[model samples]
Target: MMDFDVELIRRYAAENKIKFGRASSKAVIGKVIASMPEYKTRVRELIPVIERVVEEINSMSIEDLKRYYSPPVKKKVKEEFRLPPLPKAVEGMVSTRFAPNPDFVLHLGSLRPLILSYEYAKMYNGKFYIRFEDTDPKTKRPEPRFYEAIKRDVEWLGIKPDKYIYQSDRLELYYDVARTLIDRGYAYVCLCERDVFKKYVYNGLACPHRGQSIEDNHELFDKMLNRFFNEGEAVLRIKTDLNHPNPSVRDWPALRIIDTETYRHPRVYDEYIVWPLYNFSCAIDDYMMGITHVLRGAEHRVNEVKQSYIFRYMGWDPPEYIHHGRVAIPEGVLSKSKILKGIREGLYTGIDDPRLATLPALRRRGFHPKALYNVILKTGLSSSNTTIDFSMLAAENRKVIDREANRYYGVRNPKTVYIYLMDDVEVKIRVHPDHPERGYRIFRLYRGENYIYIDFEDEKYLEYGDLIMLISLGNFRVGEETLEFINNDV
Candidate 1:
């Protein structure tokens, strides 16, 4: 391992016209001594390290040598990003929506899809909406409070959706689409047991009930809606290619009999028993709500396939699908199940635990909304996965908040040092270093006090007889016990 930066040697080799290592170590040392000021003191220690780097550079490829010499010229793109015009976008007619389950509060990672959808809508002077995917009331249930909490967070981020929808409230609409799908022979009610269905499906074969008459399936479906079928007793399956390579996609389930008595929904408690599944409710809503483009994570790519079948069965066109990669953070808890577990187990205070990356936590910690907005704009629509380093967010926050935040002097440990002065000292300190026109605060040091507090950490920089320059006040020397007033030099 080299003690010094390897780039230094490569750059030095390239700059000196000595790519083949014909130059001697002494020559490199002499050149460093001439160019660098501190080499005069550390020349003895850095000699051998520099010599080793020179030897290593001798065998580097010609292309690598040139790479160090001349880096690729980056195209001068405009810093203000006008994101590439979305495909199939219509002026004043584009529409986008962010469909999130109202289980957990919105977290930092949720900002991507929200920002993309909202910004794309605003870009075309179109409509943006938020659809609450609250259909899975038993497994991934929604809370009455979260429906409003989600809206509050979005509004806090300056996103005003054109509409807000709850899937549970639209059960009747989903039932209508299911009926249409059944009439077209694109869906069927399956009564086979879980294991029996898996056996038939895994073998690329249909169960006995898959070929039931359309009229018969309708009767069974009505029974399910009327609470006739118990949980797992029957499910509506959208008929797809049973021989398809993806086993999960083979005649996937659309709606199931959810026993609301056992696990009640917060919004529609025991109101609807047979509820639509994710793909079913989402597909129905997308086409019905006039969604022009669907911007979501790439993991939902298979859901598009299931939803497309429903749209086709109804003779409707599916919305444009844009699936980007997932966004992750180090040790972040984005899973609602894990977060809910933590809260129930008393490990976390709530969804707004300052330790977590929830929107409320970041807001309480004073992170500006534009900081999160800039982060999303920087990431854009890359298909590759994103792992955010929070320091980048902090840097962005500093940029957003630094201009308006007033300056203040804070010290951990204050050390009182005796000061001998004949008169009081008054100084005007700027409230903000960048904006002097804002105002100034008057600081007065009384002479009768005979002492001033210095930061404990700054004491290490003092010597027996060193002078400390107090800006706009004067210079004073550090005495054995007292601070010697040097001069009234501002």
Candidate 2:
């Protein structure tokens, strides 16, 4: 059933709920007959049981009637939730990607875009890619280990991307694009200091570097590639309207030199000193990689405006963009800086610590991928910030585990009891109450093998004439001392 149908069904399925204008089940049958009407997912099977319950109630003794009818537990259907269609999508040709920095393991917030991108790609029979945006080594540094860790986390979630890439490896491509723009006078090498250019751009005035000849700009840009310019000595700027409202967008920095001798890239080492910024590399890669659509958080909406200038200057058709609001888990340590610090200070064991909201942490806790699908699709493609709790996911997780996980019994604060069977008999136990088709686990109870364990907490009512069920094994009545085997009804 759809999400809207779930609440109505829940109220109808409540204990002693009326089905018609009044009660539907007969006086003797009670609410059990009405129970079948509330379960639309299992209506085919429940309908037959309703008729059988009505037929058998007349002959059933009052004692048996009390045992026969109890409300069935309402369950979340295993079926996946529905999501809205992608805007302006072209089936079989549409492509999407989840581009993440490999600085740390992905957290729950990352799933919002990652799942949406992957599902949309699968929905359109198109390609999904994972591009590591690992260009900034000074501040948001990338580590080699997290490269594989991120991929492993994605695999654990059953996502297989069609392609993978790293922006750090494409420095030459960014350099080549920068050269083309400089030669065409769409971009120029700025010699002005950082504060100097900010004042010029924001004041609706062009810096001296902005009005340089095409040859001079090309010469300086080639010098930048050849390491002739020191860090912060020069930068390539994409020319935009100085009078634009967002001054940072006007003449945005496309590429800049980093002092690799002090702050080195993990992969490239000190080989390259210059790197493309987020807007530049992203737009260029989106164009080169034929990324048809971009699904990212709404915080990047301004970045889209910045990137559009590069695409416009290059006469390239930019990818379609969809921005969503942030996804937050309040109890989670989502900030990468905080997480890294926690690990360094030994506050957390690692990225997969049970306290974390990282994908690895969730996987380690036995969460099913269906749990994530249900939660994400319910919050699908919206611009509203969402706060999620772990229990919300665990509730959906139990639905799947309840049907599949095998039965195992464990008791804390144990109490031992000895019982001698009248004769050797086999005790049969179904693997799962809801799924008897999985078969049963059988063990023969020897006449002399009489010891069993129960929780000491259950010793509260240990008196003379009381019956207790050993789960699926059998029913036993308490005598003067030991629990006596009465019957195997349960």
Candidate 3:
């Protein structure tokens, strides 16, 4: 055993427990220490220090230490293994992915997950892949422009995925795994009608074919395949325990038959009968892609658990799951679908309409990518749902722009006002009051002229004969709230 400082470890561990949850102290400390590249290399030399610390901690009274060091509750051990020897080189472990279905353009909700994945990948020096989960040809509408838009948005936000993978390209891989599962007696074909199948399975009601062997169902499946599936019949399902409390654990559909009219595969020339379900395809892809960290919205938390079972059944290592909240727009705000509808109906100009939260709209509104990044940092990662005020984002944007942008005078909504001049003179006016170094421009004035151009709102504050100031120039008495300017030349 290496010599370690037991007392120091106890103090550090107690402080960590107070900071993080009691159960998270060790992991938190380990993570913190591992993050320091310099310290990671000296871990072997530091083992003695850790041993001494543990020894001192062991000497403390169990009852007294209970107040400081709350041991975590023991969990049921599903597997057992001895700790491996520390490696010579510190390996970057985190691998995250942004899996977006190509059905719609990326939204604020999707941006949150991408940001989390990107940040984690950067923090751990890990690889992050942008995977297009473009399954379900029935619902998939491949818009090349949408993919281009997403790429531009991600790049603008300073996020770069290590590689781009498409689920459509991996259909053969999914089919191979599906066949493996079927061969292993882990999945079975169900030849039930769509509506009837959903009603029975979702309600947890037993079907007559529930416990039928795959071999026994093969002939029936063939008949159904020929009559319904090939022509236009059957769905495939995983044979999980029906008594499992979670409805998701009950034999869930792994594949479904699609109508020829509704389906259009990108690569497949002929109409296909079977299609991998969401959970099945996602689990297989994540495992194959070596995704170590699965960071996604909390809405998919249940789906992650189901995927975990799929991984377990296949004897594959399940990735760490981090569920973050979904981003919800204010009520009555248009959804992406509604926005698309608006575009189609000519209700709005395009996807970049200023009212929507699309990246192009944000860019046009003068919002910097750094400001959007700061918003994500401030929001952090939470499993609970959170709503962000649009104004809050606007405020952050203003701070960034105000620091770098120079003020310019723009006479929008201008109206003619009159000011009496005793003599004809040329006045020099600075283009910007605060930026006097930018120099001045000459404006010719007319003798006996009583009017100049000003915004209509400015006229309201001026009394008929009240003194008004033209920025940086001598004050002038307002003759009257007149719309006439002294000749177009002046």
| Highest TM-score model number | 2
Candidate 1 TM-score, C-alpha based:
0.82
Per-residue lDDT over 1-490 for candidate 2, one digit per residue giving the tens place of the 0 to 100 score: 3222332222333322221111122331333323333454565555455444333443333344434335568776558566788878998988999999998888889998999899999999999999999999887888988999999888877899998998988999998888888877899999999998888888999999888999999889889878999989999999888898988788899899988889989999999988999999999999999899999999999999999988988899999999988888977778777877899999989878888888888888788887876688778888988877786687778866777898866767788887656678787777776777888888777765387877664565456765556655566778766778877665
For each of the candidates, give the backbone clash count. 0, 0, 20
* Reference-based TM-score of each model: 0.82, 0.83, 0.66
Residue pairs with backbone atoms closer than 3 Å in model 1 (clashes):
none
Better of 1 and 2 by TM-score: 2
| Candidate 1 wrongly placed segments (more than 4 Å) | 1-79, 447-450, 487-490
Lowest lDDT 10-mer window, candidate 2? 15-24
**lDDT by residue for model 3 over 1-490, one digit each (tens)?**
3333444456665544333212123343464354343455567766556545444543444355567665567564432222221212124777788987666666656667788777777777778999877667676655566667778888999898999887777766776776677667777777667677667767777666666776755554555445545522566677776666777667887766655355565545234555677899889988888888777788787787667768878999888776777777673234777888989998878877777777776677677987777777666676677776566677677756655565656756688766666567677766554567877777676666555566664545555544334643345555544422222221
Candidate 3 least-lDDT 10 residues: 80-89
Summarize candidate 1's per-residue lDDT along 1-490 as a digit string, tens digits. 3344556655675544332223346566765655564556776777887777666665555456677677447564434656778889999999999998887789988999999999999999999999999998888878878888999999999999998888888999988888988898988999999999999999999999989999999999999999888999999999999998888899999999888999898888998998888888888889989999999999999998878888877888889999888898885677777877899999889888766788987887788998889888888888899977566687779877877788877656898878776688888878897789989988887774376677675565567776565566667788887877777765
Candidate 3 stretches greater than 4 Å from native: 1-91, 198-228, 246-248, 259-262, 267-273, 331-336, 344-346, 360-366, 413-452, 460-469, 474-490
Which has the greatest lDDT?
Answer: 1
How big is the positional error of residue 276 in model 1, measured in Å on the Cα after superposition? 0.5
RMSD of each: 10.2, 8.4, 20.7
Tell me model 2's lDDT, rounded to 2 decimals: 0.78
Candidate 1 positional error at 354, Å: 2.5
Error of 2 at 361 (Å): 1.9
Q: Local error of candidate 1 at 47, Å?
A: 21
